[model samples]
Target: MAKIEPANGLKSAESRKSLRGTTESLALTDGEGNPFGSDSELNAYTSERQTDKYGFIGGAQQYSEHSAENIPPEVLRQREAKWLDMLNNWDKWMAKRHKKMKLRCQKGIPPSLRGRVWLYLSGGKVKREQHKGKFEELDSQAGDPKWVDVIERDLHRQFPFHEMFVARGGHGQQDLYRVLKAYTLHRPEEGYCQAQAPIAAVLLMHMPAEDAFWGLVQICEKYLPGYYSAGLEAIQLDGEILFALLKRVSPLAHRHLKKHKMDPILYMTEWFMCAFSRTLPWVSVLRVWDMFLCEGVKIIFRVGLVLLKCMLGSQDKLKTCQGQYETMELLKTIDTRYMQEGFLVREILELPVSERDIEKEHLASVRRWKETRGELHCKSLPRMHGAKAIMAAEPPSRQDLRQNPTIIVESPLATKSNGEDKERKKTKEEKNGKKNSSPTPVAAYLEPSEPSPLLKDTALLGSNQSLSSTEHDTYL
Candidate 1:
């Protein structure tokens, strides 16, 4: 429902009237009624909207590199060069020097190439390639009326201040709707959740609708399993783990939270669900997302913990929080001091929480939760952190793991038995003084070029999938 200007020379009123009947096909057009996949310049219509380097179209107080200190143009150029090298040689780094790749992500990807890097990080690009035409196929179909209605209502609220979704039914909103609707169609059982709108909107700001859809897919399935599903089950489990982690990371914050009996969900739900897209300032949001996509939800936990320590870790900071309401107020208005991109990213990197530690705590949390309830709404645990982990958990990777290596037997059992008998007969004939007239016999043996099912060992429990000699590369 973007405010379409008449100067653009396009009639949106008719499109609006037909939307009810053509909602399924709406993904086929841009805001100006451009062809579906034409991808007409997304932000060409900025006009007089005051935008930032990040394409934020508003006059509001935005926090970014300017708010603190700017990265010098020279250094940014060097980093961009290095990023280009890493991207071109992505397979080399991912296979051998992955630690270096991770270190590069912590420094932050250049905004110009963030969407491509994000596609690499979240495994979305690969997923799209693996399952071609799936997003379009889903987009072509009408979404479930129950979920589509809710999705349409929430479209305008995704980033009302941002240029993309500023117009109610602009191209941005149209793309956002397509991505979310495709997801619902892609995953009918999961249906939809309100948190997904902002998340999808954030992705649309970077990538096209199709890539954004796959990015959302990776987020839901590989990055944060069961997060947007029924019962809010996975997120609740993570909430408990976050509190438990808080006890160790910041004991004072833990004591303060416990004193107020504050549950993590009351505050951290949006933070986790939206991946802090809604909470942090724009650049800070991007900075955190750069790490979040690279490091997984632990970065999110680290961000939450870092903020908690800064807000209520000290005696003086705790004195103001006399009750739950004050504590909530403190958490809601994240002071700009703590939101500075540089400081927050550094703190997150140094946080002592490791994936092993989180996994340990996760298992403990799940065990405790089951003590009270015999079953969890969603039994799927969160996948391990990082893009490598994302690809490793994939079916192709598992299929490789499940493969039984080919074992060739070169023994001459079939040929050797006949040859040994012939030699014995020849020795017997020589002892009996009989003249030998036959040619010398030699044993021959070879492995078959193709494996015959008859020669296969039927008792072994394994998959028939063959293993590839070439390693799976993390490149386009």
Candidate 2:
């Protein structure tokens, strides 16, 4: 392959001169075999300043050298070498370099390599190839009109600060609209959700429209099935699952939240729905995504647990919060330093979470969620969580999940005591009428309020059937 470098004096003046007029009509011609004409005269490519007819001296400024920050050049070279090897033999890499893949992903994928790596990790490339030209077919027709308007309104809201999506009808915005619309066409039952906008927008930043579309599909269908579905039932189920884990790991915080009638939905909806896109700092968001795409939803749960523990696990911090609303507000807006790219990446890797741990909890919590669906309702759980609460649907069958098996990474910290003995001791004390004298302050879960406006729109919430189909294929 010929290296395409600008006229930067790397070649001798003689060579540059010889390459000018000597160039042939190598380009494909028109129907008449006539070469396309250029209005500008074929001038010698030069680094020397040129004088125009008016005798004004002119020359282009030398281009500046750009490089990624914080990443050493040697490290980048090593990464490139590894990436090239993986690219050449992806199957071999997947079989023999699986550990390396996880390690490199944890170290943070090079920005230049992120798109290709993400496609490989998420199997987006396969999905894209499978549905080749499907995007164009979908693009030829308008999507559901209801979602069209909503997607249009939300386009400007996604990554507006980034150059790609900043301008109206810019490449970024156009591609975003096309991708989201195609999704609605592909899965009308889900239509457009507020959360999918940011997710798709982020993917577009990394890959081309077709690849980004498949990446989005992989995320919606494989990584986090049912997350963007009507009513966000998947998120609701995950939210309860998160709480169940929280109770085991951070009992004090769980008890405090229960006492104050603070629901996980109040703070966790964005974290789950958007995969922490709008919530985490931009740099941290990218790093989280690298792991999330490679490891699946377990990364989301791990990061979520870490964030919650840092935010609310401290007894002293919880003591200062005057009420549930203030605590929720505090939880919503965390310190920027904690979410900084380097620090957050370090924490995510150091956090004692493993895929095996998440799987076990996911299964049990899902079952518990189904059993407790009648007990939990939309009334007290904030409406911002989306759609309405409903009875848990039947879990995905085992056969459906055979294609995407969860990788089990064991962690010593995975198994934590749920404080069952403490619960028994407290209950025994209560039976002995010692509840009032118990040292720990008791905070009980609150009664339900009347159904909110969110639940009233159940008709528009649609069904989770589309999500269930994909969810079974990925994480059942």
Candidate 3:
């Protein structure tokens, strides 16, 4: 296990010992922990570590491990030092150096900093502070029998090979239950899904259960709304969007897949649902996640596109795959040995897709799905409430899309790109013999009506906000 350390400095040996003792006390055993539900079927996996080769955990493909051991310690320290400086003055850094941070995330977040960095990226800390003691409260109550029963069966199936979850009723499995169950209570409308278990497991590996719960919230709500709900409307819409984009970017691969009657959901659901955790090699999964959290779901599409290109776009490779079975196998079984970090990440970055592109395509894809289903209401519209619900009611018009800075469709005004705007402004300023003015301040959202307790914890800290109204409105 990674040694736990405070941001300020290392803890004393006594403190470390105390932490270990508490952790051991919390570790679950067959007779030691509370059962999730009345179903005795789950008892089979909880009695001992499951090594079933046919089960979900057993069926999962393992890949070579990647670690910081490959990099120089001194180089890591230098980067960590720079990141630490930014983290120390996070509010200032977020306000002034967001672009720099996004660039850094694209490169990779250091393993040591990933836990905290992910919390920040997903606004987990803010949500955690807001919901102090909520996890414990929800966890203390018995979960709904139906949800608990479903969650119990899948507990041992997640990351069964990992040290954290290998043992029956281990800390990892226990925490995963709390997080997933708390979410069921938190958003009863969505209830639970099997895909959510792996996603929550990934978060728990990074932070405490409470922090992980909120991080999961940001992912399901802010990052991937409508994805874990009934009917999986958003994911189906995304599959169509992926197929459409595939046709535009890799028509040869698209045509081949189409000819075989392959649907995007056939291969892309797990990719989208688990964020590629169960698909990619461990190292590549981490690297992909670093960019995914930074850029949003667009990275998922970009990576999926790259995989399709490799599998079907190349004639030589396509010739080996005779039919849908071979094609599907090749799609799921990615070989990361050839996916060198330097090359694969570069290719993902170089891909022509952007968040704007994905959003625009998503709008059309949802419309297509809704029309086909003939629903009176746009059932594909994400579930929102209060102010957000009001925003979603407004249909996105050409005028609205044109005014938004990020929705980069074929607008004549958008012909002058952001880069062009900067260059043009710079030239004008220089010609007039005036210093270039500071860029316009982004309108910060989520301004609380009262003083947040978070402000009291750190005087320098400011209210963390969502994307600008224009950007947020587009998502709704």
Candidate 4:
């Protein structure tokens, strides 16, 4: 098959001339994606050099730590301490104490530990170990003529203000190029997509090329499969699912979307495909990523829904949006307050966007797509993650879910030890001076009056009504 041209706008004439090959391997004093801090060295060639505390150049040096991130040194130490323990016993946490691990992720991974935890959470560490020497081998190769030029062309465009990619050809761009090229070599069929550049660039900021390569692998293959594909059928499917979910989650927003014929892809593609790296502030990007790695794509859905609700929920808020283009503009440029790491993460979890809901929506969307647009155009449905996304069963069923979907999100604080509950009960008994031999369980399993429509050929989220719209994808 003839390979596709560069998705990012790059001069075709220059693209024919090969960019620098990966003959020179990168060797750094530091290892791993976890940049304990910013990894930028002032670009010697550029006079416009000013690095923010969060690490972007040419902008006033700034600090916009998430609310959760801005804590007393003591509190930071406490979080670090807990994370250290969790890191030490990661396997146990993944299997036994996963809820605790998830709760911790929702709070935020310490910036220092972010890279390491991401490697662990995304199973990137395991992938690297399993495929040892693979990335380095691919990195050292000349790379495919098809993707190499285009990859090189887009390198400077990614995170241009960030010190990493500021220079025309620096370690950041070089590493980003190598990672993208290697992926082209690794998955030659999917080839290169422009969106992968920013995603790869984001990974390169924290980890080395090889580690970043594997992390990108997990994202494309596991977290959001086929998102960066040549056709981007997967992201398109998700857009449909997101829109369908919106109907239940936010009727007004859904109606406004339907009224203006706003496609989910118009708003959701960049947000979900880039994983909100483009739309959100850097700190919030990392915060969202922290949960994304831990809990899988549900975080993205919750975030999209939250944004949709905020954007068009109220009659007054709806008044501001007059048309599709205006709505698209609003979505593309999210409000700064909504992008706060502390605020966004809390609000994301506060809304209930469970895996089951996503799956049911996925099945319904797929059925509709098959009916309307035909099969996903040479694509099989992407695999959805189980409760343990890092290591999961294929297409996890409703039976595999830990809890049923509910409106209110259960706070991690509410997840207390039975010993604490027992202690409270004992105190109450002492005060009453009489103890019932047995106390009723706070939560009783109530059998549903009717069986589920799990396998029914109908719109499950609705009363067997077929979903109408097919959402549209391939975000940059």
Which model scores highest in lDDT? 1
* TM-score between model 3 and native: 0.67
Model 1 CA deviation exceeding 4 Å by range: 1-49, 59-68, 395-476
lDDT of 2 by residue, 1-476 (tens): 11212221113232222222111123212454222222121122112434332121221111112211267777876786666456545655565667777787888876556776677677666665556679889888977888898788767656543545545576778989999999989887667766787789878766667767887877777777766664445566677677777777677777777788766665676677778876665557778898888766767877777777777788887877768778866776676566766767777777766656666766776567668654322122211110001001112222321232111222222212224445777888889887635333232211111111221222211111111111111110
- Model 1 agreement with the true structure over 1-476: per-residue lDDT tens digits: 12222221112342223222112232234564332323233344446456776656552324455555577878776776676566655656667888887888888877656776787778886787778789889989988998899888768556655656666577888988999999999988787877777788788777677878988988888778887776666776888889999999999999988888887766677778788877777778888888888888889889999998999899998888899889988887778778777788889989999888788888998898789766776656557697778756763332222212223333356457667777898899999999668864442322222222233332212211111111111111
Clash-forming residue pairs, model 2? none
Task: Give TM-scores for every candidate, taking all chains together and pairing residue i with residue i.
Answer: 0.72, 0.63, 0.67, 0.72
For model 2, the stretches where C-alpha displacement exceeds 4 angstroms are 1-69, 374-476
Q: What would the per-residue lDDT of candidate 3 be over residues 173-291, giving only the tens digit for each residue?
A: 88889899999999876788767877898877766677678889878887777777765656667888899899887898998888888877667776787887766656667788888
- TM-score: which is higher, 2 or 3? 3
Q: What is the C-alpha local distance difference test score of candidate 2?
A: 0.58
Candidate 4 residue-wise lDDT at 68: 27
Question: Scored by CA lDDT, what does every candidate get?
Answer: 0.69, 0.58, 0.62, 0.65
Which candidate leads the pack in TM-score?
1
Worst 10 residues of 4 by lDDT: 467-476
Stretches off by above 4 angstroms in model 3 are: 1-69, 338-340, 376-476
Instruction: Kindly report which residue stretches of model 4 are placed more than 4 angstroms away from their true locations once superposed.
Output: 1-49, 58-62, 65-69, 380-387, 393-476
